[model samples]
Target: MLLAMALTLWSSIFLIIKVGYCYVNLSRKKGTVASQSSTHEGAFLASRSIDGNKGQTYRECSHTALGHSIAWFQVDLGGEYSLESVKIYYRNDANWCPYRFRQFYLDVSNGSAGSTTTLTSQRKRCYKDNTTALATPPSVIDISCKETARYVIVETTYNAQEAIYLNLSGPVLEICEIEVYGCSVGRYGESCSRCHGCSTCDIISGACQCGVSFFGPNCSNACSVYCKGNLCNNVTGSCTNGCEIGYYKDKCKWTCNPGCKNGCNRNSGSCDNGCIDGKYGIECYDVCSVGCISNCERMTGTCMCKKGWQGEKCRECSPTFYGPSCEEECSPHCYNGTCYVNNGSCIDGCTRDYTGDKCTQGLYETSPEDHGTAIGAAVGASIFVVIAVVVGVVTLRLRRKRDDSSKAQKDERKESRIKYEKETTYVNRQDHSLPGKDHSLPDSHVHLGKRPANLKTQEIGLYEIMDSGNGENKTYENDVIAKTVAPVTNTSNDASEENGNVYLVINESQLNSSHYDELHVQN
Candidate 1:
């Protein structure tokens, strides 16, 4: 019974300790509630009225309770304020709030209080934090107040809710202060607009700087201007110094002496004082006087000659004659013959009775001994005739024989004339009597007549007589036999008709018999 009473006493002590712990926790929560209630009084103002902890500030509000579990607070600053920036102190202690509030909304209005108008809105978030790091919240937020506005509202989009307490077992949210500043018109941060001829500066507010190769407030200078090494002047848009010799143009950058290794004038293309005579190429390096003949220029020797003159020096004929020495004359021979000055042969053959170089000479008499034996026999016959014949009888017989021979020769000549006429006349005679045959006679055969008595004696004798100038009379015996034949005449009318119809009629037997004795004598 005593041990049981001791145990009961211990249990009572433990129950008292538990009750004391609960009372302390309740007091702590009440204190926190009081602090929050007091801080909400001046939360409408931009600047904090109370500082609960480091970087912790309070903002005033017009209404204590704003409908629903979530609430919104708004403050109106009359007119369009050039908002330099905004600052926020976020409450982030796990022991005070459920979780850290991460996101917030900033809204702008037109008036100070009643009938406020909203101009714009923006959402923002706080940076993450560590346990030991100081809770210095972001101090600045930029806003373009292009439109006029009076009221600005800060609304909580996210809160430290129960989701963040699974591991850390408490809420984490805080705010120490909020600050706002008015910036210059049309200016924000370190950047500003150009004003009163002043150039627009950079974001850092340093002097308006230009590009590496340019200068001036607006960077209007060219790259070549103000350049030091082969540089251009800053004031002007040209090179600072002119180009050196053998160089020209802007900054002396281009080489004026191309293809000239020795060197060249930057302005002219002459060598030494002027180009040497006969040298006139790009660098005056070519020799042009060697092969020129006339009108050769001293600077650039080129030949000009008259028509039909050609050669390196115009010293030869213009292709009219072809020879190594150009001295051979053109050929001149009869009948289209071509005879070289060095050799004498006609292209075809020498002309008749012409001999010697180029066949220009006439015929000359040959000795009797030089004449053939046939010619000798002809001479011998004439001599023998003188011995055998008496003057009177021989003359009469010779005259008769001549008449017969002339008639025989006339008949032969007539036959030849008829043959020539048949060959020359180009008559297209149709032989209708003999069908399927046509005769074409030459034009020369159109006239049928006796041959001329001037028959060539050279052809008849087989040899030409050299000369016939002897005082002694020489003749050949009348070897041709003669017969006293009556002349033929057509007395009867029927006979005349028959004779007229015949084209030609000759007695061959009579002509042969009459010429037989002469043939034998000549043989």
Candidate 2:
């Protein structure tokens, strides 16, 4: 019986040991899983390349048939724990991949050495491009474990042959840091006291309190004075109805008296008693009336006129002067020692016998018309002399005409006798002349160039010429011939007629004859 009992006790103890071993192993596995899965609070985890190269070491997963470039990273939670989310900070090296880890697999396991089970799997492209550098971090992926996870593993889906030699060949992806978080267990009371009963709370303090200008556990109550009446000092508890005496609105700080027109004290709202000496009015701007004089002090007072003036305010002249003053005397040219006070002048041509100052002097009597008649007689005598001179000129002209006619007749008879004598002498001497003597004479003398006496060489009037041409002709008057023959023409032909128009002509013969006649008439 004892042996059996010992055996039973030993078996029971063995069963107990076996149970203890299993429990310990299970606890260890759970601890390992928790350590692997629990993310570090506020800590960054970096995924670096083994070769320590830059962008060439990491790459983002592709989407072609397979996926983008793949990258793997793991986190070990210290103990058995539950986590609601995980975050990875990563930067893409390629420009094509900019989204975070949108498509990824999160694997969780029990312990340090156990199979991994994917807690969550996603297929969306997380990054836009992959030009990110390795120094950059990874993005976060929240995986709900619901109080069950411990170890966590990340797997990126990549395109087939997207990476060459474990480096990104298509687009590179980089990871600079990582962060993980776990939900708090109720065993330690509320995880955050500040947000205990509030839907939102302060992230740093974690206290259950209101935000600015608010109160109450859930930030539901607002302070009263801040939103109501006139401004009230929260700290001093003071209320203001209006601004003080000299102060205006807008915090009751500005002063007012400086702009008051009637000498007001702005601060006290009181008026000063004194008015400006020369001014009076609401603002002391009106001036008092003083008359126009150097000594007048009041604006409305009358002015004192000088020695010889009289009128209202001394503005009128004296009676003697009739101007602005009464100091002037009447002029001296008035009639018979009297003076016209208004105009200061003498009366009507100063009277016949009066002259000198005020027309009081006697004058000498004389008739002015007698001198005018004497001047008229002298002018008449001058006119008679001018008429006599004109008559004398006419008589002399008539006498000259008669003398010229008689002298011309006498010269004509003498010229005719001399011409007959010269012709007979030339004819009588012709028989006694030598044969060569005829050729020896000058050309002019040979052409019957003998001088004649008794040539009638007078300028005759047209009447005389017509009377001689026609015995008793009266076609033209004597005055007409004198006027017409005043101008003479010298021409090549002594006399020519063309189309019944007579033209006086002159040649060498006419010129010589006319010249000789002019010389003889002068002698």
Candidate 3:
């Protein structure tokens, strides 16, 4: 029954199995082809694609209609296969290059529009050999698609019967055989058992190519517990981006000591920033005072002892050490060399010469060392207080000096101003004999007490007068102009109105029809 079914396929090849389509299917499943074939309606039926028939005779071939530019034949493989490659065999009965299939595409789908996918070539050989005439038959095309699908479609173009376009009778699509090669069912290779999702497995040997984290024969073994998320290199079991936080060692087998911030260096186990909980020193070996408010420095464990406590380990100061820092000694008057650390009170009896608890009086003789220490402390405190006061006074004085300097600089940069006085200076009409000399223009604008050569006269406009008042018409950087202001009674001769350099701000109404013409002078 399998051989009979294979013979009826007529036109194309079937699955690239060892035998016929019957063997490829193992169980018969229906297929459909859509086209207008001149020979037989079902001649290019989809069943032929997997029939394993390579016969090239027209009577034994499968051909699609030449009326349309595109046609397709799809096959339901009954079950999804992780297809490896597609092998297509064209009719070999005669030279059919003119009607030979030229342009086409292959597509696959999971029976839904959203999942429809077009198969692409994995190698350069998937392209057509257009350099030479495709006159011969037995032409086969092989393509690969590492995808899973139950429906395989071959869409080809008929060239719209344009023979000369491709130097042939017309582009046509005909098939004689097809073969599909890939893993079988849910298993792969000769072992017949699944190699799982590992694509690196050696199918023949059932040995795994082993990706990160997995190891052993089939790459089935998970990474060691030390590995983060059980992930590591297959062979070395070493993490790639370094060990996860708090974990260390080559295999991340070791963990950081308790109370670590950013864990420790992989090999050295030293705290990255520093140890917490008052541990100190390079490797955190040195211990700080128990009374310390915070941890000590890393390099040295010298306790920044508490307020009341003194000493390296923050131990309470002894009677002999009595003072704020507990480095000073008690009075020599104290019997048995005993005195309170907080105060100078004698713990035992006082010396024969001493009478009070502190032995402040009497004829008691004191030790030179004790006396010198007391004198030195008093002197040191006095010197420190003097230095602090001096520093404060100097700081205040320097601040005041800075303020004074800033104010002086601002004063120097300010614009100078001079009040205008009524002047009788006027243009010397053609006859330069009698000059209007009273209250003349300031001498500043004259060169060596002489009238400037560039001086001229013209009617001054309102805007021009305003410009003069603003000092805009002044040509010199230090030039001053009257701002239409009255002169002050206290105006000193030392005002910036030195030299004959100044602008007049006469009223426009006063400037009416007078013989006095305005100066059109360019400074």
lDDT of each: 0.37, 0.37, 0.52
- Which regions of candidate 2 deviate over 4 angstroms? 1-71, 94-102, 112-114, 117-145, 160-174, 183-523
Each prediction's TM-score versus the true structure: 0.23, 0.20, 0.31
Clashes of each: 41, 76, 19
For lDDT, candidate 1 versus 3, the one ahead is: 3
Task: Kindly list the per-residue Cα lDDT of model 1 for residues 426-474, writing each as its tens digit.
Answer: 2112322212224432222121122233322211111112222353553
Put down candidate 2 lDDT per residue, 1-523, tens digits, no spaces.
9999999879856964664321111221323322222222213223232212224213421111112344445545554443434444444555533343444455554433234333322221112223233322244333333233445555544332324443534322234333334432211112322246554433333333343434454555443332223432222223234444444433344444432333433334433443334433343334432222333223232455555444445455444343223455543344443344445344443656556544545566334656678788889988988897886687677757866875667656445533553464222223332232333321111111112223223233322222223367534434322211112222325334221211111222332233122111011
Residue range 415-486, candidate 3, lDDT tens digits: 121111113243221331213333433222211122233434222232223223355674322112222322
Q: Please give the range of 10 consecutive residues that has the lowest summed lDDT in model 2.
A: 441-450
Which residue ranges in model 1 land beyond 4 Å of their true spot? 1-70, 92-94, 97-100, 109-149, 163-176, 183-494, 497-523
Score candidate 1 by lDDT. 0.37
| Between candidates 1 and 2, the TM-score winner | 1
